[model samples]
Target: MAILRRQFAAALAVTGLGVGLAGCAVSQDRAGSTPVGVADSLYWNGPILTMNDAQPQVEAVAVRAGRIVAAGTRADVARWQGSTTQVVDLQGRTLIPGFVDPHSHLGGVGLQAIAANLLPPPDGPNTGIAQLQETLRRYINTSPDVRELQVAFGFGYDDSQLSERRHPTRDELDAVSTTLPIVAIHQSGHFAALNSKALERAGITAQTPDPQGGVIRRRAGSREPDGVLEENAYFGALQHLMPRLTVEQSVGWLEKSQALYLQFGYTTVQDGRADPGGVDTAIAAAKMGKLKVDVVSYPDILTMGEGRFMQGPYYSRNYQQHFRIGGVKLTLDGSPQGKTAWLTQPYLQPPAGQPASYAGYGVMSNAQATAQIEKAFANNWQILVHANGDAAIDQMIQGVQAARARYDSAGTLQDRRPVLIHGQTLRRDQVDKIKALGIFPSLFPMHTYYWGDWHRSSVLGDPRAQNISPTGWVLAQGMRFTTHHDAPVVLPSSIRVLDATVNRTTRSGQVLGPEHRVSPWIALQAMTLWPAWQHFEAEHKGSIEVGKLADLVVLSGNPLTVPHAQLIDLKVLQTIKEGVVVYQAP
Candidate 1:
């Protein structure tokens, strides 16, 4: 490897491609480049998308020691060709920048891997309470060491998609396993339905007081726990029984999630929120050299309280040791599909006990939110605020304004790269406010494909549903924004994300937000360059440049050239992070 680096450096010098390191100088163009006898890897691809505008396309790229040394036509990069160079001919495949998933939950990903697949159609076939019960039983019977676990756990149950059109009750889960505790979380991850055993083991009962921003659904006509928990209450109950979403719990599962993300061409994954245990696990992994793809976590301010979490070596501009706490996360509202998003307008269909005009509630008061944002800003921490509804977005904008007032000494908001997560029901004016506030909306366009029909007929009511992510509007402002799968809300598939973004097609094949659909090129930017910019790592990882790390993805088909309907058909042939191939298709 050492000798290979020296040769790669020498070739880079001769090619006038040296960015920082020094060596030899030969020709400025590929025609006159020298053929050195060394290179770690040489990919003579048909189309290498160097996101760099100056060189939008390249025929080949060469890497040494995880950094791009040269990128040009096959002949130019061939100059760097050496006896040891591992040459690869990307046969008509499209190679672009590796995806940077700016907003996702690594812990959630791990959990999804470890738990049972109780998700409804698309991710799983269980769409009814009976199927959910059967799935739980199957998971328990199949778990390798189920007896050793504290309890049986299943995840990804969606009330909206279930044939019953509602969440399962405690008694229903009890039928699966009455002797052992059982808990299945909703697809939203903000709610859960526990069996009677689980509720008893978790000490959740009719007498348990609801946490400030949560609810415990009660049995009718009496104060008895119904096993349904919402928001903080659900998470709180889960903390005791399921354990916090820590890396410790994710032992083998973390790697599974990494491989899954890599399969989707994600070279960089974000853990959007982490508790104290997750923080420890990440730090330990970083110290032990266990992280593969870069995992950027934003410890939840609400979860670990303030400053008590994965207290970083503060922060790093790079993915140090494969892990780092890039920022702080705050959840101001719940999921939109779950009907818990704090919307200004009521849901088209309210919950059982709520009035027809029932909009969801906020987790914190305006003052509390402002203070948290101000505190994070004062400490110079990047902020990621989850706001799914228009009301939630409004709250975030106000909080950001307040934080700016308190921290902006020059009377201008610094480029802190604060991210407004979800932005599902944001209005046009709220978007303008987000831009003016200098916030990046890491919106979830996946909703279009996963719940567009649901949103139209149930949640947002027609027109509002059509504009869930509003990608086109963000593009209209000539400002860059990022999009995400928001897994484990939806499964993490960048192709699906790209497809939903470019198509906005619903399950019923209706175009949800035709006006909000963005072009494939713009959608790709959101997944790559825009997300890298959002995470403050654009200088190093966003694009394929001479100095940038050779983080690339080879797709089975070119997303840009593919027909709009066939975008999701694109597959990940390979994923390379820092010049190292982390995953490859079989």
Candidate 2:
């Protein structure tokens, strides 16, 4: 790759910015004389953590029109400052390249914006039926839009703690909202609890059998279906009822989500799932120049009909300026927490009386997955498949291998780099397979922190539990890796992800799978350079190099030196996109 050094400086000079700090101190010349070119903005006086290997640290940087002009000593950058250039004195803060989240549901974040203030039931083990009922009651009674269906989300209930040791039944939700439809999505997004009204509105009844790739939980001792919906079944019912919200309605939410990401130091995000309408919305926002963050949208292949979505990176002429449609996304399996992750082994303890069904199976047949991937590869499309269980990961790898054999026969598959998103339960053998096939794993190691305790106690049990989110194993296997929060599934916070990867701490403060923890620098790369490489944008983004995009986040403290547990609390003091300050902390 050809690295252009100081191209931005030349461009800035052409734009009439002078080539020295003296020009910055002087006023514009009169008589219609155009001034010389220089820097548009300068940032100095900080520990600049450039991800670039050549120049890992710098005292200052110069930017001109959204790209880095120069990155070197303060004096070197000062030469690029012109009359109108904006200067930011970092006051010795720590600055790093803006974070890039490899996998997230951006549209879901937009949806959260619509009802952000509406508190959902408490999450995790402490969430009881009584507490949930009270929270829902309060939302129903006090929210201004009570007449509308009360749709509360983000609820987590430990199967071990519930009185029934099962999801809240439709009857329980019916007790709260018979007149209105209520859908409470599980925290994992694998299951949901819908009221009877919602069930009826979706036309689901006791007679309806589980769909091919999903399940409908039925009440015990009765033929009636309960409110709990699993896997694609929940998605099917909800997809039908989800409002066809207009693009205008989505803007507010999108902006809210963007702000949250910026506050957490993210500049670019790969939206893992996007509907056609959602893509159009993002594109429209970009076209209108309203988008503050760079978003790479991948259409949801499952919802868009398999084999139909665009296969590889499809960029706009101004992709770096705003938005781009990068690839197609697929879900190979369901959530492990919900006991639907398509594992080879059965759950050690299946719910009482329910026959030990293997923790479900792949959403797509192996042959079908292979066919889909082959077609996508032929079309030069990058593919990202969500595979959370060992079985699912194996199946996905087999499909990818088949695709490589067929479409990559000449050893020139192009750098499509099909990704195994959320390779959370990867097996040792599969790591070599992934490396051989040139596939990347965008691991969700944050699971180790968010659900580590539950994973230890209930989900994976002892033997398999320790293997969750094996970051150290991935690196040792010589495979490139990226990590993400899958935001809206979890908030899009790189600090949280960094902490989880570096510390491997559970919610209860116990360090789980200590061997899996990686160093802070490696974890940072997973969130930044690795993701950029996965998206094929490393040439222009990711690191803080001379020619890279001037996207950065100024932090209150150096993340590398902060206490591991306090990493999550690291405040993003300012977020700069293309050298323009987009967010500033109060």
Counting clashing residue pairs in each candidate, in order, gives 4, 11
Error of 1 at 79 (Å): 1.3
RMSD of each: 5.9, 6.1
How many collisions between residues are there in candidate 2?
Answer: 11
- Measured by lDDT, the strongest candidate is 1
lDDT of candidate 2 over 1-586, digit per residue (tens): 0111233233234332233222222222111223234777776656888877677789888889889988897656766766566655565688899998899988877665443222222223234666556656666776643444345433344444455556777888778778777776666777888888888878899898888778888888866887888888998897766765556666655777888888888999777769876776787777677788889988876666643335323443238347888878878889887778878877766655557765666787898888778867887878898899889898888888788877776867567889998887888888888888888888888887777777778777775777787777888987768888887777677778888888888778888777788877788888888899988889888988878898888887777787777887777877888877787776
Best-fitting candidate, measured by TM-score?
1
Least lDDT summed over 10 consecutive residues: which range in candidate 2?
22-31
Q: Local distance difference test, per candidate?
A: 0.81, 0.74
